[model samples]
Target chain A: MPSPSSTKPKVSALGSFIVIVWLMVLAVAAFLATVVPEIDTLLGRSHLDRTVISAAQAAIAITTVVLLILALSIMKEVYIGRKLR
Target chain B: MLQAITVVLYGAIVSAVSFFAVYFLVPVMIKRLVASGHVVQDYHKPDKPKVPRPAGPALMAGIAASEIILYILTLDSSVLAILFTTAIAFVVGLVDDRKVMPGWFKPGALLLAAIPIIVLGAHPDHLNLIFGRVFIPLLYIPLVFIVIPIAGNTINSIDVLNGVASGFLIIATIPLLVSIAIFGNQDTFLAALPLLFTTLAFYKYHKFPSRIFPGDSGTVLLGALFGALAVAGSSEIIGVIVLLPAVMNSFLFLASVKKIIEHRQVKARPVTLLGDFRLAASKDKSAPITLVRLILADGPLGEREIGIQIFKLAVFAAIMALASIGIQYYFLKDVIR
Candidate 1:
């Protein structure tokens, strides 16, 4: 016979987890924004072909996407996966 | 000073028009909907009240009228692009509201909403990262197509509780407006006004103990408008960052369900109602995981509290979004320069 107000709201772990995921995603974005351009510059100085530089940039973009997917998977695992187990 | 005064004048007029349009129309739409027997049960409520639904037409009217006025005043094609994109999404949502379409229908159909933006050349060729911009002329076209559907569906998916969708939109749009004001032009910022004010108006009826649900039509329209504004304003990165909570909600549901299926098709719900009308996270492993469920993970809570929790997450995401902009402006100034 517990009334609705009888239960106090507890701080959610999921909230913290979401913030962690956001930071990870932001880190990845920062890496792309800063590090990738520097890598392009270094590659250009090495006299890499235009297509080679483009390919290298594309690889980083793909890696960024993959890293994001990994981050999401980790979130899923930590919250849903652990609960199911 | 004259120019600033004119801008303020137009902003005030458009805001008033958008806000009042929905404010007045929703009550009428509610009566009409209920008369036509278009109502849905509010399961979260203990008594299960049947709230009139599909407030889409009224919402569209409010947004369209305000945008058209702004367009006539400013002659901005970007305004037309947003208007058309939102209209198309409204139609698609209205269709789904009338018929039980496949889960893919809304997302797939929403892809068409991107057409207006693309054909009008409303988006920029470069993608704006926080620190700098990347020219993606070829990739930008496909990105436009992908982004509209994702944005439309993200808001739609998050509309599980009363007022969560509209309230989320209100909070989420803050960072977008800030970003647009900072990095984008005035035309796009003016174009985004209706979205903010219309939702503000509709939220009066859509909030806790909702008298009228926005239905699929209303949610999709707001979502599509958000997507359109982001692209047209070239604030795509900020837009995505602010929507992390809704995006995460969509991701969790899809991952748990392992498919693009309608939520109604799922037998096990992520949340269950207690006898006292509080919501508890479902213990059934088969149930799909959702943001609301996660919010209730610690214990059962009233619907209003859960909605507030989601808003808190959105506010946090907005702060992070602002931080991202700060990083670009302050920390990475040299690189961007």
Candidate 2:
């Protein structure tokens, strides 16, 4: 398992990082989805309560981030193998 | 109304992310595949010989990864209707990427991919045709799947150049996004906006003489995303029309491949270069066409020139997108109320 390269693959690594951060964001969102329970309570008491659209959006975002990580991990694996070969 | 909007927007964003993710990862995947010995590296061919070694497998890895992610995300969010459709499209692409299937099998897969949408409440209820007094069925399930996958594969074929395939996709999406805006489909607007942006970013690196190629990953992603969006837009006829540009490009490439193959057989040569654009040449041709020469040439429009031509057609697709919207407004506008 060679470390990811800092050359041509740097951009891909950047994408991987984006996905990683996105994953964190999604985790926080899913947590918030359970913790808040109600849209009004979530928004009135917390900073994230804006619209039902927002929560649904967070769900979509989290899902996308998770997907992004899956894509990037594939990329990372491919990139490292290519670089080494 | 709000919930509907959210759903549409979610679809659009997912489409966008799906497209770019595939585009970005394909090159790396190719490198990996080459390394893993799953695919062999063709180094003997001239043109960009020094750019590491990965090639075909990268395309597969990128495509497979993106599709899996797409399916997972769809299940996670319960966007079931489009999920299975995309999965079918992905498998079709995967098969195409791995090995050539029988000609009929390809079309069969396309039809299969179109099933989920047709069955799970995704069909467009509006029908429009050129001739008067001809009653076309609103639930045109057969045509939808048949044509959509054909369109998808066509776009995939034409996507040989950098920026060309993605460029056409962005162009096609603009009108869809606009239609959503005018008709007040806010959710779709939010989701699809990112597609435009991500594709643009990809274009920056993908344009002619590209640093990287989209390969199968990019092509399959574009195909599925476009198919899903067209269906999700609920403006099927127009979506099909807007995609005509890609249709033309793909046709041209297909013709070229056919001619090249036929010429090779007729000449009894190892390779035959069609016209001046030498993808592969007949064994007898003294000056066989090469990919490098075709890319670098000023005249004798080869794949590069054809790619740009396809882009021009995409600009025209904007009109088709608008027309589709208008037609949708005529039929479905009242339903939403």
Candidate 3:
């Protein structure tokens, strides 16, 4: 068998794209981490019922989860779609 | 000034011990393992050389010895926590290396590794989320159990090509070391040196055209220790961020396969070996998606090139991790403390 080639491979656009997506995810996560607590404090100061504040926090948390799922879905679609093409 | 000198000396001793231990032990392991007929074929290579595996004992020995010395000097329970967690993960991985285990075995077994951290009270109640911190006193315990298995299995999954596991560990570790140094105590920073140096020494042999593979034991030990370090140092988010590529690889694999199954048992490989020995993404839709496969989406490449690409992704993740650290330092400095 011939010796395997040692040619340098070009970094794919997809690799760069994935890194960008990762950054986006981090940014979103950081934004939520910063904002959610403030939102909780603001609601607390408004003298809203404890149940209402808790419900809003839970909703925000659920939305964050949904967003993460959507991002993963996009990643999977892009990966499979690229291969198919 | 005298305190600074002592800290430097301690760090140097830990680094030297771990580095030299793996450096000296790997060759002996190769000879003994091969003599005992415990070798596996390098599937990605053209020659199909039989390489001895489970360099785990040597790796564990190096890490444990260094951490033991650190604990003796400082009497820190966190040091003991890292050492015990890594030792337990090493044993779990070694068992898998010697036996044909089901897919669930390693992940399930790794959860037990978290016991040392919890029992030793090594983890913090608050999570550092870069922009803010969250006090998750009750939730953090379960998170510890989940994080170890995820970290252990994530590294285990990415050990596909030669040097990838060790190489990835070397890259992914930089941010952890940096984060620990910035936000953690001197002891925690000293505790992380062995991880960097051990993997560095192991990579000399485990790199392209590997002389010996890390197998399950080595990978899981490194991964679990990494998780333990992050937890012990209170840099969990930084750990996850630095390991995003491996985490993404695991996510893709699980999503594509839609089940917890051994890669060995999977009938459809994500990448196919070509005539020239370069790897191409499998055209089969049934194949599980992987980072290697994603990298090969554009075209086939040699194993070493693929490894380099993976490292590049890791470096990108490391940069992002550093940026996250910057965010914490510049913006959340008052909030975090």
Alpha carbon lDDT of residue B80, candidate 3? 96
* lDDT (tens digit, per residue) of candidate 2 on B212-318: 45554346545655665555554444555566545533433343344322121233432323433333323332322322222222223334444555565566566
Taking chain B only, the TM-score of every model is 0.97, 0.65, 0.98
User: Which residue ranges in model 1 land beyond 4 Å of their true spot?
Assistant: A42-52, A82-85, B331-337
Q: What proportion of the real contacts between chains A and B does each prediction keep? A: 0.36, 0.00, 0.35
* Model 1: how far residue B61 lies from native, Å: 0.5
**Candidate 3 local lDDT, B1-337, one digit each (tens):** 1278888999999999999999999999999999999999998877889999989999999999999999987888999999999999999999999999999999999999999999999898877877677666766898899899999999999999999999999998998998888777678889999999999999999999899999999999999999999998888888988898898889889888888888998999899998888998898889988889888877788888899899988888888888888876675567543
- Find the 10 residues in a row with the least total lDDT in model 1 chain A: A1-10
Chain A, candidate 1, TM-score of 0.75
The clash numbers for all candidates, in the given order, read: 0, 15, 0
For candidate 1, the clash count comes to: 0
- Reference-based TM-score of each model: 0.94, 0.55, 0.93
Ranking by DockQ: 1, 3, 2
Report each candidate's C-alpha RMSD, comma-separated, in the order given.
2.4, 19.7, 2.4
Interface RMSD (Å), each candidate? 2.9, 20.9, 2.7
Output the lDDT of residue B269, model 1.
89
- What's model 1's lDDT at B194? 85
Q: After best superposition, candidate 3 residue B36: deviation in angstroms? A: 0.8
